[model samples]
Target: MSAARWQRLVDDLAAAGVESSVLDKPYTESVYGCVHHGVSRSITMLHPVSGIISISDRQWSKNPDVWVGWQVFREGRDSIVIRTWPITKKRSDVVAHVLEAFNTEDRT
Candidate 1:
């Protein structure tokens, strides 16, 4: 299921002309999270647990009920990969939003 989700995400991004990469291995280091890259700025997508914990603690204020599964991180110059899911009322909406945001951002 996750693999399918990942592929769909990749396809969607590709359709939108957003460059992204897939992290095939588990990420272990804080500095080298599961997925790391920069869109307009550097961003790291830690493992699901790490991503949720970090976002919850700092950004979402540790809201357990809040969904924080989907995440994205910079893989390299002008590239990023989706690493987890976002808490949203609608899953499709969340995906669309992410793609829209990425596409809207200036690559150069």
Candidate 2:
């Protein structure tokens, strides 16, 4: 990914009020060794106490156009596996859905 594109993604995430941190080269290289290099490509978005989402540089996922959630031991893992395609979805829609999950009082 180009630096400009990466910056745009970071800006979009910020505008949505999602706390995010860019994964450094060491971390990204270790976790996503096959991903493109030379520019920022991975970030971790945190939803307060609700969940964490990984924006990987891989750009493609098993499901190319949707967000995938995983549960841990029958409990809400509160984790979402987000790839490039879904991140390109309307931010309002993504933010709304994520906010709904974060705002829910009952996790069961």
Candidate 3:
């Protein structure tokens, strides 16, 4: 399932003319008392330049729901986080978020 989702994400990005590549290994993220897994090497063109975006898997912790979300970092600068709920949102939503971020960065 993850592989299919990853492929779809890559394909969607390609359709949007965004250059990106996914790593084979799962990336580990420790945040808010929970360990989240994501795709490694998800380098994206956050701007005309380049950036890194992580597609995080939903993690459940007693504290709160720190689930699937996006963390976009541009050229090693501060990250722009876009959080989504339920982790069941359509893949198109992710693509739209990426496109929106891309457009926003393009304007700056």
Best by TM-score: 3
> Which pairs clash inside model 3?
none
In model 3, where do residues sit more than 4 Å from their true spots? 26-43, 49-54, 62-88, 106-108
> Global lDDT of each model?
0.38, 0.45, 0.55
Clashes per candidate, residues 3 or more apart or on different chains: 11, 0, 0
lDDT of 1 by residue, 60-104 (tens): 446422333454332223344333335443435545655544434
Order of models, best lDDT first: 3, 2, 1
Compared with the true structure, what per-residue lDDT tens digits does model 3 show for residues 1-108?
556766787798789887777667666778768897755434345355544344544445554344354433333234444332234446777777666665444222
lDDT of 2: 0.45
How does each model score on TM-score? 0.35, 0.43, 0.53
Error of 3 at 25 (Å): 3.0
What TM-score would candidate 2 get against the native?
0.43
1 or 2, which is superior by TM-score?
A: 2
Off by over 4 Å in 2: 26-40, 60-108
